[model samples]
Target: MSTTQSDRLRGLLEPLVDAKGLDLEDIELSRAGRRRMLRIVVDSDEGLDLDLCAELSREISDKLDETDVMGEDEYQLEVSSPGADRPLKEHRHYVRAVGRLVKFQLAEGGDLVARIVDVDDEGLDLEVPGVKGRKPTARRIAFTEIAKARVEIEFNRKDKKEEEA
Candidate 1:
């Protein structure tokens, strides 16, 4: 991994994302032979759509190309939304996933699968998405205990209503 190049790109992307009111999920810089790859993942308030990604990709690609940041090579620029299975590391990840199903590993070596109810300064509140006959159970989880947290793509009954509207 080219750490310096990646960091340089991060510096360039941060303000661009903020100015557009979008979150930068991740970035990757790779080179194979004479080709280079610059991938950027993004998310927004209305959720990520193909159109939005394409637009952002074109804009960023143009800017990057102008700067010659990827070096003089045939580079493929790919930009898209973070997949549903993306891990939620930051607090903002949970907030953006309020109506989505998620799975998180506990510090005690256990895991929880539930629908994220909300995210606040304190922590994330997730409601167990109807485990068989069991009703939704809300759990307040702190950041320290979150060993692994990622969005779950499977259908969750609890989030159905929210997704409908």
Candidate 2:
């Protein structure tokens, strides 16, 4: 999307999202075969639910219908949360991913898989899991060192509560 269009869309839709207590993570307007597709990714510190997304979709759709920003074209408006696999681009994204396992692609070279323990404006404090019964190690990674990163999904990991039970 062009910068003007993207900025216009953010300007138009951000307030609506803010009013509903959600952060506007991203907006993408693209072609989907015959029709245009508008994907709005929203998030909150408290996370999101399906019901909230459905409501936001309705509100955004109404706002688009009232404006000429989309030029009256029939486009599909999709409102949803960012998926776990989505790359962490913003500082807020990293903050939100604290306590979650993340796989990082280092700007210098190789990859690192660690759990985010803390975050600061400069970088992250990560707990690198142990190998061969050794204890986990603490490491700090500057934002500049992260070429790319995403939260890693752990299906079999047990939570503290589950472990206690």
Q: Which candidate achieves the best lDDT against the true structure?
A: 2
Candidate 2, residues 36-59: lDDT per residue as tens digits? 999999999888999999999999
lDDT for every model? 0.80, 0.93
lDDT for model 2, on a 0 to 1 scale?
A: 0.93
lDDT by residue for model 1 over 1-165, one digit each (tens)? Answer: 556877888888777777777988888878878788888988876687777777788778777877856777788888888877888887777887887888889888988888788788878787886768878877888888789988877653455566678
Q: Please tell me which predicted candidate would have the highest TM-score against the true structure.
A: 2
Clashing pairs in 2: none
Candidate 1 clashes between residue pairs 3 or more apart in a chain or in different chains: none
Candidate 2: segments with Cα more than 4 A from true spot: 1-3, 159-165
Model 1 ranges with Cα > 4 A deviation: 1-3, 129-132, 156-165
> In candidate 2, residue 103 scores what lDDT?
97
